[model samples]
Target chain A: MATINDVAKRANVGRGTVSRVINNEPFVSEETRKKVLKAIEELNYHPSSFARGLASQNSYTIGVIMDNTMDKVYANPFIYEVFRGVEKSVYEGGYNLLLLGKNTYQNGKLAVERVLQGKMVDGLILQEQIIDSEYFKNIEQYNIPIVSIGKLENRDDISWIDIDNHMAGYMAAEYLYSRGYKKIAFEGVELEKIFARERYEGYKEFIGSKGLSVMEANELLQNIEGVICLDNIYAYKILQRCKKINKKVPEEIGIITFDNYPLAEYLQPSVTNIEIDLFQLGLCAGSEMLNKLRNRNCEVNRIRIPVSVNIRETTR
Target chain B: MATINDVAKRANVGRGTVSRVINNEPFVSEETRKKVLKAIEELNYHPSSFARGLASQNSYTIGVIMDNTMDKVYANPFIYEVFRGVEKSVYEGGYNLLLLGKNTYQNGKLAVERVLQGKMVDGLILQEQIIDSEYFKNIEQYNIPIVSIGKLENRDDISWIDIDNHMAGYMAAEYLYSRGYKKIAFEGVELEKIFARERYEGYKEFIGSKGLSVMEANELLQNIEGVICLDNIYAYKILQRCKKINKKVPEEIGIITFDNYPLAEYLQPSVTNIEIDLFQLGLCAGSEMLNKLRNRNCEVNRIRIPVSVNIRETTR
Candidate 1:
């Protein structure tokens, strides 16, 4: 219940000095700043978000524009994991986070207007599904520092962070090939999935360069020894098919899958997987956004959190 | 990019009138308000967060005070489910959400000061773990309208929403008893968990009133026919113990558990469970907060979403 007057009186300074300290404007001496902070802590003085913003014009908040719908965000745990990451780092970085959206949802981009025009936030961390020319222009016009969660292609106007999908795919195949599997095949996913396609291209590029035929699971009868699956469910089905065909896994077939194979360890032949740390992706994006805010002249940075392989009995 | 002057000029009103319309003051005539809105739509002028707040003094934002640590939120999907519910409804209701927390994270309560002192949010949604006497007194001083996610016993100064744990337990026992199981037992959970204790108390009260003795899972050898587990893993363990003891399931030994038995359907005999929709809890909390905001004189509301039973093979 203490007022600014009380803090000013206790600190032996005028009201203007206390207001300046609270607003974070320069000109107060170190001694005066300490006295004001000490008074604030002792008296439990607090200021409103708008009161501070009115004078300093800094909201000291960040906005996350989730360009995906609620359905997609709910279906994918990765988004929440990313949120967990972004929230932790940014909360640690001394900024509030505003999840930008309107009451009547309109694909998410419409939510950007309020945040941009209101000066509601210091910066933004975007989880955009696609970056078309128009969408990119809308964001660019704001001229604020932004860090995109997923990878953006061909432009370095702002920073972006994602896992190296091609590298992950290449490594999955290389790991299998290195384990004495002569005929390694890649399983199928919908060709249009952006991340999956990038990984598939990586696997294909590796297989093609090595003169290996692009094969599916059904072709295990054609003497295929290893099958790397982009999807975990596909891996399990292949495992089931291998069992029905009387092929002994590891001895005759080897399987490796991407992460999030629920109860993957419970399978008769437990599946090995490439684990991409989504939390780390969010963490890097958060800190990167923080870095941009701290240094206005910093160059556009490109970051990719590395993936690790969890080896299990499927490749044993 | 349109300025207030441009919108005012377009509407044939002075800058002050346009500002007044944007500030949402009631003094503006309905006709003038309509003109300003139309001009704003045509010009797409956005008032900054501070500009609107300078006169109206409302932030138009709500604060979600997650009193638990980041780790707990990450561990419990229920928390995130509630968040998704709260976020979806509130966003649809046209209020932005501020997840308030400090940089160092002195737990979640420390973040409340800024939101409370600054009038950063119009109301609050709390996901608290423990409500000690003194800890709550600090919050009570703020006098903001609050909606707590879990049940609050004996205090109705504000509002609280949760599943009816006692009813859920009573229903589970009644279901088993009505299904012709003469001997039933309740499994164990840590004694300190509040919700679990209430549920167990309900089950015990039902059984005691019915003249049946309280029994544990291992007591099944002595003619205990059905076991209701508070935890899913415990239920799975009991299922495994029955298997090892050569007891047939559903035919000779029936079992049931609470929801979130991940892949429960994949078991030999799928487990039956009482499903509590956490998202519903959040939705009610959000709408309740919105109701409180819309009507200052509204009564303190108590809401409990009912639980649904998933009848599977384990209880067949």
Candidate 2:
């Protein structure tokens, strides 16, 4: 088989010049590059990736690490959209995506150990679901560039891109309140997740500002005239519960939720929802990670994706 | 800053001994292994993945190449479930997944070139949507083991795992036909896709066996009492169209579809669907690829995943 030496010998250039041409490194003269290319084409030489990696110290691959278990990631379509966005940017940036499942790590330390030991990826895009985890702290030792999908509390070392969860919640609540529904119920908040908690806080802040007390879901369903759900899936359940209780939607009770999933439009009373652009969020995260990978001093380290409310039949 | 030589010197062993210990290769004595481990820990030596990869000639990562575009993959929840299954098995097997999107390849040759030149992954799990593509033909040159998610026609070089689309379609037709529905309509058949075409053939074969004529979706909706949809998304569309035409589901018209997605039960008149175990399919593909990667001679090359029907409100 043909080797780099063979190509260099044929081109009458040094091995370094051949390596530069093969790696597409700048500074090589056009005359020398043309000779190297012709020699490479004639010799049918293909550079080994390991050799390339050893030369550049870059894998041209990004690791997408999800904190949530596989089941949880697949359960929510929002994650898929974000992944699609990340996939698009990664592909456009000339990098492959390495999906590291939750099981790949015991904790943050193990995850960092695996990445460092394997030199598996050039950079990482982490999906931080839990707020209090020590993942980011442990990852600091590696000095590898990382971009997170969700914000980390009390940590500025890593870059992140996230939807404005608080604003999403506030919009849902404010829309329902403006529809004259005094009693509103908030559902599906897992305080462990930073985003969910932020959304919940936004809802409470909106209700507090209006001088309207936030009611429990059960209480609101029986007495209140409206409910702001956490997401489209939650909205579907609320709609089902309303049917069981013989209450008419948008008449006796109005509804609004987050995530304008297809089900929101397909439901009997199509749900009014906060359209969080998960795809754009993924794209932002990918771009941030790419920037960090390409440039050590990336000026814009954090990004907040905006959300919009899509009014539907649930709000009448 | 610590290197393998430092660990080898500390352990009182040769560099090859330390290399074998780090690579986890067989033939190294347990006592020597323990000594090397202690030295490695004491020195805090981190092995360069490129150097390790060169020694072992394995990346410990598998590439998942999707034939269809990212949008199509994300549009259907089934793909996510399949990916979850693959992710689970891949994680358990101690390998990372590299997602290669459609845009990665300009053509079959370029796709093969990227995989070969980069040495990006040890093996590949290809999602083949079309049978007539030159992808498999070109991939034959690379001698790289591959496991396809769907079956391919006229090619036995690579292994594949797929649900029995013909059976799935037949079962749907049989169930709806038994319920006293004649002149049933089959929705969403793209002849280019093997599974879709298989399903269409199954439906046609069933209709032919019963000496009945298949009606168009428009005609069936106007006259027939039942319809067999292509999948859950198609079923949802059918339901929407029914509502638009003032036709009540199940009461005035019955429906059954493929892929019992989560929203199937949530629909007003819940859809009866063919429940395909996509996660299991993914697991099978992952396992098949792993076996091929680990063993040159695998017992089972072709696997057909089973599918069942879930009767719901749409059928009742």
Best candidate per DockQ, number? 2
Question: lDDT tens digits, residues A1-316, model 2?
Answer: 5779999999999999999997689999999999999999898787666766766787777888654454533356567667777877886776768876554542233544566665768887877663236655565566778787888776677788999999988888898888888888788877887788988999999999999897768833778788888766777888888888888888888888887664446555678888888879988998888898789887747688999988889876
Q: In order, what lDDT does every prediction score?
A: 0.74, 0.76
**Over the stretch A1-316, how does candidate 1's per-residue lDDT look in tens digits?**
6778999999999999999997688999999999999999899887656766867878878887654345433355446667667876777776777875322342243656656667888898875464555665776777888888877765678789988888888888888888888688888756776678877887887788888877766644557989888766677678767877888888888888876533345444568888888878887888998898889889998887788788988886
Instruction: Tell me how large the interface RMSD of candidate 1 is.
Output: 4.3
| Stretch of 10 with least lDDT, candidate 1 chain B | B100-109
**True-structure Cα RMSD, model 1:** 4.7
lDDT of 2 by residue, B44-145 (tens): 777776776666777777888654454533355566667777866776676668776554442233544565565767887877663336655565566678
Against the true structure, what is model 2's DockQ? 0.35
Model 2 chain B is weakest, by summed lDDT over 10 consecutive residues, at B103-112
Q: What is the interface RMSD of each candidate, in Å?
A: 4.3, 3.6
TM-score of candidate 1 on Cα atoms, chains taken together: 0.80
**Per-model TM against the reference:** 0.80, 0.79
Error of 2 at A261 (Å): 2.7
What's the residue-level lDDT of A166 in candidate 2?
93
lDDT winner: 2
State the interface C-alpha RMSD of candidate 2.
3.6
Cα lDDT tens digits for candidate 1, B1-316: 6778999999999999998887577789999999999999898777766766755777878887654345423245456567767876777676777875322241243556655666778888885453445655676677778888887765767788888888778777877887777688888755577678777877888898899987776644558788888866677678767877888878887787776533345444668888788878887888999999999889988887898788888886
